[model samples]
Target chain A: MSITWPLFIQVTLRLLEGFETTCLIFALTLVLALPLGLVISFGSMSKFKPLAYITKVFVWIIRGVPLMLQIFVVFYVPRLIWDLPAFSRFNAVILAFVINYACYFSEIYRGGIESISKGQYEAGQVLGMTKTQIFFKVILMQVVKRIIPPMSNEIITLVKDTALARVIMVAEILKVAEEYAGYALIWPLFYTAVYYLAFVGILTLLFGFFERKLSYYKV
Target chain B: MAFLEVKNIKKKFGSNEVLKDISFSLEKGEVLAIIGSSGSGKTTLLRCLNFLEKADDGVISVDGNLLFDGSDRSTTSDKNIRRKRLHFGLVFQSFNLFPQYTALKNIMLAPEMLLKERAKKEKLSAHQKREEHEKIVAHAKELLDSVGLSAKEKSYPCELSGGQCQRVAIARALALSPDVLCFDEPTSALDPELTGEVLRVIRNLKSSDRTMIVVTHEMEFARNVADKVIFMSDGVIEEAGTPEEVFDNPKSERTREFLNRPGF
Candidate 1:
């Protein structure tokens, strides 16, 4: 059946709303996970053996499991093990995404931070900067510049991964499109690709802008 | 009490001892140059002086303040070491200017972040704090001017040449006005031609009454600028004396060997 212009607008607006939720999940996960990733990186890189080992193993487990499976585990395991009520689908989806992405981001952060020469730290220390001062003032921005490329890649992947929220019954873009597909209109499913492409295209441009801005650091 | 005193500083890396019983004392306005081949622990000794590398056994005093007693380096909290570290400013061979900062910002950062934090802790009035901030900014500008990089104050480390970056690094180190300045092969990272520009800046510092400890391979600079010269041979001081005594009338076989190498 051919869709009229009004019908197309209606479908597009509905998908846009769904995309809003997708963006929210993406944004919140990033906001929480980025700083959390840095903290986890410190843990993974800690001089204390037990803390470092535990953090590394946890990161490994999170990264080793599939995101979809992690979503299931996040949604079900708390209730299974503790007899707690299930969390909201949005909460469960974000929880899983945040934990999984944080592990990935922490590894990237650790690599970026560790790759900095020991001399940089020494330079800061000699200036009488405290450890916290050294990390925040000297190390943090340089680490941000170094990690941006890999970080942007992960973020772009997160744009696509937001669809996985559907596994937890969160009505993000893909799930919304799937609902339309039940009406024998497959065009809406194809239509979902347009949203993802536009979203990712915008992200790619944003990341390109950041990379250009940070190029001044020169490694 | 000397202006700077380092007593029996020893350091180890795993199975290898990098610095062994290194001791030195500097008077106010005196410059000491440490010359040695790579792996001789000259750099390590300098690093230990600033508590950058924890010494296994030693005592360091700067302006009569005890930095740490190496008998228990671990027991010395990081806070104590960092506070004591303010007494010494170190310039690296690689000119580790913060790459993300402009040359002026590199000089301004330590003073701004540090002095402001200290002022904040004292609960200084905003007007007082503002005065402190302005003072640091003006001082940073003056330092940039002194280094002959006033025109390049806005330039990032990547934009500056090797000598310019080292000068900026020197300016940054000097921004805090530490009791002593330590240079670890400051010119080794520059081109032979560019090395002259940095050496000239350092030579200017020689007459300024700043106590300095330089670890370098520039024999001519060592002879000309240093009041005393130390020849480090395999983690120990093979010879240390006035420039004439060490350079002209070499005594130790190892010191003579290092000075009389094929290049010399």
Candidate 2:
């Protein structure tokens, strides 16, 4: 097929609009999930047996199911149970993505936190620091250093996982590419691969920088 | 009155009974070395003294002020526990220096937090807070120098040798000037050559009349430096006396066997 300059430009612009939706899903999920994951991790690690068990089971359920199935459940379950109006397609995608990613992030957080030696907490305690102070001032950065590699891997996976929104018919980049495939123009579908590669490449660089910055400490 | 006193400190973990009964007293300017085999509860006693572990029963008084009383519910509050912990500083066997911070910053951190808290409580002006911060930095530098690591202020824990890290840990513990500084096998993690540097800094602290409790496996160090020596066995003190009296003339069978072990 002969490709004209205008045709390529037109396809690029439409894909960019769809890419905005993809980016929004990625950014919003991260913004909401990062802190929420920390809270969930604390709940799982709580001294209260009931709270800890419930949080653990919740995280287990979220992780055991597939992401595509989760998106569908979020979109359909509320309306089915309550006879309420279905959520907006975008909100359902966001809700499902947040819960899924937060559970994964919480496990990474728990691993990083539990890896620290008990001696660190005892050192802080003997120095007269409160439990909160010990966490923020002493343990937090060490945990960050330990979790960065795992966190970055999960984050890069999220960038691609945004395409899962297409299952909910959210007109994300992949959905736009698929729409072109219906027109029997296969090149734009290949062009979509370029965008994902660039996005992941940039993220790889960013995470590498953070890893180096935190490399001064060997936790 | 003793400078520090403990009455029947008892601790248990799941009925294991790690410390059945521990009681001791230290006068000001005295060094008390607690010598014991592993599992003898020496470390637990130190942890309890620092409030890292709560003793099930005990009375701990520092400078003649009651710090912890198991019978007193009012003394066990979170706020009271933190305040009481300030009376003691502990150096761990592993030299748990904050790895992300430099030696100087590790020493400065707790004191800075303390100063910040005081500044808020006192409603100090911005200028006053800045001045207090400078004082903390200066004090931290002085502590680093005292531990003979003046040249290593900016090095992280990973960059330092085990001995160097322990010295920094010592400086960090001394930054707050606790009434009683405790060491829980402080040199046990170092190489034979490296142990000397840390021991030297501790010996200097002794000459300065800093009250201390040292839990150690070093028999010679305990005999030469400690004014009082305790031999612990099976969660209790098997023998307690002057170093000469304990080492030269041990009364307990366990103390005699422990001192005559192959390594000693």
Candidate 3:
């Protein structure tokens, strides 16, 4: 248990490698989920009863269950039901995270969009803009401004949730720390806090910037 | 033929009737003011004309072009409705300017979209599109100037006062150059002092011969500015005439009582 430069550097490098995986999962989940969430929100809000109901029920199921269990389901259910080869642990983690986050994000999107007063739509209609034109041109930015605060909260949560990837042996940063702890070196596990805090700190500053940029308008 | 004619415009909200057989006509260069108590359907009538609400039964014609026919489903298609909506621009009482855009961009947006569409249809070159966009900007500036908001072009709706925001909304509505402009109580959301500035803008618009329908609670504004005044009660026109006849010598008991109310 001697504290040495080599041991510190080795632990740092190993954690950095695992942190890369964490960052990848977080980045890819966000890139894929944001737009997919919007589309799902539209489906939930659709005028078509069946589509809306089905989307709502799907969102309901995804949100009602625990994320870890969902990961297990995603990883194992295909093999169980279809007799197919198991998906890579990383892919399963991604699939579960995207589906779960997209559902949560869809609810946030729906709330932001529906919170806009009817007057805005009426104003656009009276100006002779089509529904599509009205949405993209008039409503979209306002919705973006309104959703930013809530979206940032969910996004920060996603940063922490990347730890869940370790359950399926995806070997994210926390898992690397756990491996060090198993060697009876407990301090390296506590050291994982530095990486997470730094990552969340950057995200907080970025979201703050966006919120300020959109502060020119009040929704 | 009337420049704008609405025949038997009826609207209902589930079990409740909001507008009942509301019929009126406006000649070019005239201002028609509708005065009514709340729930009397004045706003609903304006909404129907602007295609914000589809009247359960009606025929609307602007400049002799039949824009809406409730009996014929063909005329009520989404594309046709949007096209017909261009004939009437509505200014809401709440002054619903797009908050994300500046006052000038709020006015310019619809026209910019329209010009872009037309440019695409005519296969105009990129330079021509830019020229058209410049024209739209110039026109929006002119409209802002007309509403006495020339210096506030860069201000967001949140930055502007209620009256200034309404003026921007007025300019935004005028940017489309509809055949008729409609206002659903433009001053209702403003303070008594702020109300004067917006009312002044509407009065100025009148001298320039803009045809307008104003649904208002301001009895004085209605009486002083309207060429024709309509008194609505219980989803019907209680009285319709020149301001003198309607306000000074109301024919219906309801109209007379409404006019005598303390605020009026």
Candidate 3: which stretches are off by over 4 Å? none
Q: What lDDT does each candidate get?
A: 0.90, 0.93, 0.92
Candidate topping lDDT = 2
Q: Name the candidate, 1 or 2, with the larger lDDT value.
A: 2
DockQ of each: 0.78, 0.89, 0.88
Please rank every candidate by TM-score, starting with the best. 3, 2, 1
I-RMSD for candidate 3: 0.8
Better of 1 and 3 by lDDT: 3
Worst 10 residues of 2 chain B by lDDT: B73-82
TM-score of chain A for the candidates in order shown: 0.96, 0.98, 0.98
lDDT of 3 at A169: 93
lDDT (Cα, tens digit) per residue for candidate 2, span A120-215: 998898888888999999999999999998999999999999999999899999999999999998898889888899999999999999999889
RMSD to the true structure for each prediction, in A, is 2.0, 1.3, 1.2
Q: How well is candidate 2 docked (DockQ)?
A: 0.89
**Which pairs in model 3 have colliding backbones?**
none
Residue B137 CA error for candidate 1 (Å)? 1.4
Of the pair 1 and 2, which is ahead by TM-score?
A: 2
lDDT of 2 by residue, B26-102 (tens): 99889999998999999999989998888998899999899888899777665678889899989999998999999
